[model samples]
Target chain A: MRELSITTEACDTGGCPVRVVRVSGYIDAHSFPRFEREILTLVNQGNNRLLLDLRNATYICSTALGLLMSVFRQVRHNAGDLVIAGMSEKIANIFNLLGISKLIQAFPDEEEALRCLAAAEAS
Target chain B: MTTRRRDLALMVPGEAEYLCLVRDLVTTVARKAGFPDCRIGEIEIAVDEACANIIEHAYGRRPPGEPHVGKPQAIAVRLALFPDRIEVRIRDRGRCFPPEMASSLDIAEFAASGRRRGIGSYIIRSFVDEVHHSYRPGRGNELTLVKYLAKGVPGG
Candidate 1:
């Protein structure tokens, strides 16, 4: 099965570590483990502040949202934070309907989300 | 016996591995039936979720990453194309699920729960126009999703 492509770049801005994971393609029940494993691995590596970029994701199923929640809970449990950015229109609609756009830390793009995470870390 | 008519049918092992195949089949059938792109995406997702639920709950399989024991089950998905709508029935010869699981989704509560487990069934119920579930005792379980096409839409 073709899984979501996960490219994680670790950035340290003024002593704050933010792991930006850019995911492309579909995120569903079958493919969510790839996304989940990446985030869990990053969290294990101490890159707690996270920015999951889904702008290029073709689709995000509700099960994938659960995967995101697992990552969110993991980051929060470790006293770190997580945010998402670059949601495609379809993904954004699903997020909006599920209240994720309102409940989670979200931004229009990676840059904005990185800035927010870094700023929060600095505070 | 649940007697009915079906236009297309496809079956896959009740494992998460074959969800894409089911989704692709749904997409092709929905496209041939003249569903709009957006609506087609919704149908694809809803069907995917239905199949997923069948794989998990019906077959009694654990979530991904957990060690699965014993043999995998099989899930059958059928489609019925009609003039005003499309109906999809997903069947599994595994354990039966509660008929009440097809209840309406509470978006607010679901989000408040951190968007956890119930999202799959919720999405299946939300995106599709109608959803229904039936249990055949020791036989199996069947979940159906329906999407109504707009009037005068081509291929209807």
Candidate 2:
């Protein structure tokens, strides 16, 4: 199994300060710590508006999903949002089955998620 | 008729890397056993949850120390590939999950709650074909998960 790699960057969405974290490879027990660390760093830095691009993500375990929910809670409590974007149908189904869709917002693409986050922040 | 069989065991320190290794191995084994892409994903998720439970409950975050108190190896994952099914057995020498905890977990309830942490065992049961647990008085606990592939698949 390959190591899970998460890349973070501040995406310039026509003036909205949104951070995009691209998670690739497998997100099982092994890579969850790194995932938690990066999300925590983003939250601690006060960058709460997040768009997680999972277009390249091959797998995500319940542990990873749990961490995402924890981060979402932290962000929401701080008046920010964590959005998931570009999840594969299979992965999306897992999220849906876990009822994550009800707790966090999801979009089909990064651009749409960014737009939604931007609009929400402006309101 | 008997199917081809492959069995191996891994003794992993309670570290994140080992968890990934287990997932990889399980996925590969499932694929080799002719599981469809969708089923492979299911097996991967189930295996991860089982292993994560062991790491968190058995080893308690940090790696086990020298002279390993109870068992020289705190955790071990065993994989057995049969013609029609793949069985993953995770063994840990830690406090067993209280019978109450095991009995109270209802998959339907957890699915409705959507709370992240408590759904592991439930999810494992829902995704796999069969899930069994045994706590031998002196031998510690073992969680066995089996996924049976559909007939048209391949390995068998």
Candidate 3:
């Protein structure tokens, strides 16, 4: 089994102010602590705009989904936004079925999510 | 005519950290039970959620200031693969899950509530054909999940 990890990089898209968080491998209760710490560190660092890349992530338990929601809310609280991209169809449908899709914006890829991050911010 | 049946049992300490191993075994069993790849994914997720609840609710996450009771409890799962349905039973002795919690949940209400919890039961019921839980005084709780095979699918 692969280990879970959260790594980051900062990129500016026409002054859009975006931070990319790439999550991979299995993320469950055991690994959620590191995941939460890294994301909150960014939020507390004032990097509000975020693009989450989950193409490589294999499994995301409910705890992880909740963590994502927490981060999304925190970002919005600071007048910023977050969009996720590259989820497997099955994973995306889980989020959709739970209605998380209604609150969080998701895209097929990072590029599309980036293109619409600002637009989604209006919601 | 006679058909063959297969059953497997696993017992692990009631804790969240061991779910990764449980998911792997469940996926393997589901795959061998003739479930499609997509269905296997659903089974894996549903079982993970079920076990997570057992760890969190049954065993109770060591309260902030309280010490654990000597050692954590144990949860056991039994998988029975038949020609008609794949049945899984998870048994725990720590605490009994409310019978109603396994019932269908209102997605809209859950969303509006802004809560991250309570979605596991829904997922388990959604992914499988049927879910049933039984409890006995001080005996234990058993949560059974069943996924029916498609018509014409061979199990024997």
Candidate 4:
């Protein structure tokens, strides 16, 4: 089994706190539940603005992708946002093929995503 | 690639922990079959999605993160390499799935509908060139996915 690690951090951007959840490894059916629980815990705690750092994540199955879409809706409904960064072409291709990228904004890296989210939160 | 055919087969317990092993096997086979890096990635995801579906739905396992109290069943995976394409056949004794329902839906609408599942079929359909499903009363369900090495392969 591929190990999936989810570590979270919060950056106080003066307007809203941008929570960064960094995940590494395969987020397949076996691991998505933990991933879901971690993210939902943050959301339920009022940490809505999120940056999903998938830079180290090698692969994400359909189940996990579907969960992200659902989470995106939930975050938006709560007046918060969920964005992703550091996806390889392989991962990005899957997102594009499924149209998930169309709904969830993805940046090339964490720095760019943080900047964009910070700007949005400030404005 | 040559006209000569090559084949590979694997049977693993229907558990989420073995999903990565399936992906790794597919990747190794695909690379050896001469698929490019990008196409190889697509094939890996397609096969992974299919096997995941079998483990979760066919074997009656609970959703992710939940334990399955029942004993795990066997998932048989067969790969055939042809001159122009590669075909993966996954077999399980679990319930049958409607092949007609494997269309790539509008992701935005599906997501907005608040549905969590039904994306596995979408991924399998989008990544592979063709999907064929058949089930027998006692022979179990077989789902075959084909991917062409190039864009214009006949029937691909």
Find the candidate with the highest TM-score and give its number. Answer: 4
TM-score of chain B of each: 0.78, 0.74, 0.82, 0.83
* RMSD of candidates 1 onward, in order: 5.1, 4.8, 4.3, 2.7
Best by DockQ: 4
The numbered model that scores best in lDDT is 4
Every candidate's lDDT? 0.74, 0.74, 0.77, 0.83
Q: What is the C-alpha DockQ of each candidate?
A: 0.33, 0.39, 0.39, 0.57
Candidate 3 colliding pairs: none
lDDT of 2 by residue, B44-125 (tens): 7877777777667665665534243554345688999888888888887766742112323433344345455765665676
- The predicted structure with the larger lDDT, 2 or 4, is 4
User: What interface-residue Cα RMSD does candidate 2 give after superposition?
Assistant: 5.0
Residue-wise lDDT of candidate 3 within B1-156, one digit each (tens)? 526499899998787667888888888888887877666777788788888888778777754335457876888989888887778889999677753444565544554455667666667767777778888979888899887777311111
- For residues A22-88, write the lDDT of model 3, one tens digit per residue: 9988888677778878888898899999898999887888777776776777777788887899988
What is the RMSD of candidate 4? 2.7
> Each model's TM-score?
0.79, 0.77, 0.84, 0.91
A46: Cα error in model 3, Å: 2.7
Candidate 4 CAPRI assessment class: medium
lDDT of 2: 0.74
- Recovered native contacts, candidate 2: 0.39
